[model samples]
Target: MREDAPVWELEAATFDADHTQALAARLGEQLQAGDLLVLSGELGAGKTTFTQGLGTGMGVREGIISPTFVLVRIHPNLPDGPRSGGPDLVHVDAYRLGSAAEIDDIDLENTMDSSVTVVEWGEDRVEHLSDSRLEIALVRSEGAAVTPAGDFHHNDPKDAGGRDGVITDFDEDDDNEERLIRITAYGERWAGRKPDLSVD
Candidate 1:
């Protein structure tokens, strides 16, 4: 609940979108309903790509897309499908949310207990939604900056409201950027448990 909260963290690097998705899929297998995943990353850090993998592992229905403009997207569990018993995926984009009060305005507590909630760009906004949560940060490695060199990000839209966070300022046409992801487990929900991050 505090900044010095009970926590344990691990670091893993992903070389591509596939690796990011694979890593998240592994975690998805271990998660259950009422779990919260907080994702932090600059634009183009594969947040959506990672969430897609999570949905796949959780056995949710397809069509996992960025909820930036839509704000929230719920991918329900697939009936009679693989991982059909898994929980639904509730993806929330908090990039435009300016405060905790705003996050509460959406009434997340209503569905969090029955769904796997993942919040993108929710570094400090949605931590209180649960007693324990998985805080994941995806960082672009050096030489892999989101903004290409010599390109000033004047009037960056992230500062503006109502964005989906799927667009990037950098060109990935020939660039293969690696992302460093750090996952931290907090509260009693994850106590004494170490995730087996065996992503192949």
Candidate 2:
């Protein structure tokens, strides 16, 4: 699902480690200061992987690992980009947040006006922090056990025959690989005089 405004979805059959880095790089190319990215998905859904790509693309300090225990990690940008104006990246993990009030203690909104903030597990809790945000939803699909080229045979031995080559399709089918990354430009630029986020 996608909209010219502010919501979309991305689907994939598998999420290898390489895809994580690639996603980040692609996002970095489109990012700028004051951008807020809110991520929502189940565990092992590649939230951190996406961030890694974004970090690399932005020329941020290497090793943009998840700040699970610490709740947040700040990656500073190098001074060699087109414009290095503020702190590079402010990465936040809102999964451990006990209550809505805890969000204020993080004090991320103060930085949103100048930095790119990526919040993991911040679906509903962090929307108040910024009116303008990019929401990403990732869904994993189950693909075929065997390939048309006959490389990977059927998973079920009973279905591995010669005459029929009986392919008892598993409930989980292999789907195409695609990342549904939705970018919503809200606020004034989107439809009003005063926008929540200003790209310029």
Candidate 3:
């Protein structure tokens, strides 16, 4: 975190499908071609949800789903009208990878100049691909009590009914469910000291 780097934090009261769309709309306005976004979070942490918002904001194909099974999905803008500056979006999911080398086999770097490349589960391994990049990490707060008990398996004794059965109350400090998102700007395009923008 550079002292001068523009950064802002939002304490999302609740992390749900709508928050994902809002974040995307905010970020979509600030992005341009040749930018890379690295997203990291655990399963069901809403990485895909955020990307869905981004896709909607970027004017790429709508209904951008997680590429977990497809590996990569390219959302191209329709060329029907007078759209001159629209850029394609490339969504990649690297959860199945064992190492950085495996990610390289896909040659994602080559697409940066032509599209906004977003990699889900891409932190640690994909940052070097660009001189400028954005990293987003998401975490859920336990003190907030946002998770519904129904979401957990009732049969598990750890989650057994009574208040006494609860091992530990979900606290932001104690629970690992908090969501954190980091966006970094890299490359010559972002080297001019522009405001760190969320793009909304």
Candidate 4:
């Protein structure tokens, strides 16, 4: 089904973590169940910060930390929140997963229809998860890197075959940092639909 869907992309520049989150919130308002977001970027590039914004836009419960230790965390939508109604947020960390098989081992399909799944460090390993998905890559400005919430020096992102940054926890305390966020939608699920990513 994705083969017929034309791939389209949107790019934006953010001056701080909150700015990045605000943009993600706009995109998050457009997402629903069966949606998948695969994040890719270097360390401290604001992946976690972006997810936090999605939670806000989706009206999910607060405290959306990175799934570093637990590997997976679910944030259910709130009845009294901003959006009022939406699917839960399924946050996943694919850093330790070396292959697609490992990704399947987590059994995400159980909630695939009930939640919006987001995976960090899933650049090359999440194509099979869904026929249609949103692939987001964050490029941080040089000399503006912030410290990741988790200690993730396992492998240098610059030398890891150009895969992506390691999975780390959410960091909301980072100083002003510029990030170029590119969002690409694939598969027929997004056919004829253009999302509004404009945010203040």
Query: What lDDT would each prediction earn against the true structure?
Result: 0.77, 0.59, 0.62, 0.77
TM-scores of all predicted structures: 0.82, 0.66, 0.68, 0.81
Superposed Cα RMSD, model 3: 10.5
For candidate 2, lDDT tens digit of each residue in 18-71? 654565565576677787778865666567877887787777787888888899
Q: Please give, for residues 1-200, the per-residue lDDT of candidate 4 as tens digits.
A: 33624366655667778888888898889898999999987667778889999998899999988798888999999998887778999999998889999889999999888899999999878788898898888876555454322211222222324324523343545535767676777887776675877664
Question: What RMSD does model 1 have?
Answer: 8.8
Give per-residue CA lDDT, model 3, range 10-103, as digits (tens).
Answer: 2232345565566565576567888888886666666777787777767777768888888889988656522336788899998887678878
RMSD of 2: 11.8
Best by lDDT: 4
**Which regions of candidate 1 fall more than 4 Å away from where they truly are?**
1-6, 143-176
Candidate 4: which pairs clash? Answer: 2-187
Angstrom error of the Cα, residue 27, model 2: value is 1.6
Task: Please provide, for model 1 over 36-87, each residue's C-alpha lDDT reduced to its tens digit, 9 standing for 90 to 100.
Answer: 9999777777788889989888888888988999788999999876787788
Superposition error at 105 for model 1 (Å):
1.1
lDDT: the better of candidates 1 and 2 = 1
Please report the TM-score between candidate 4 and the true structure. Answer: 0.81
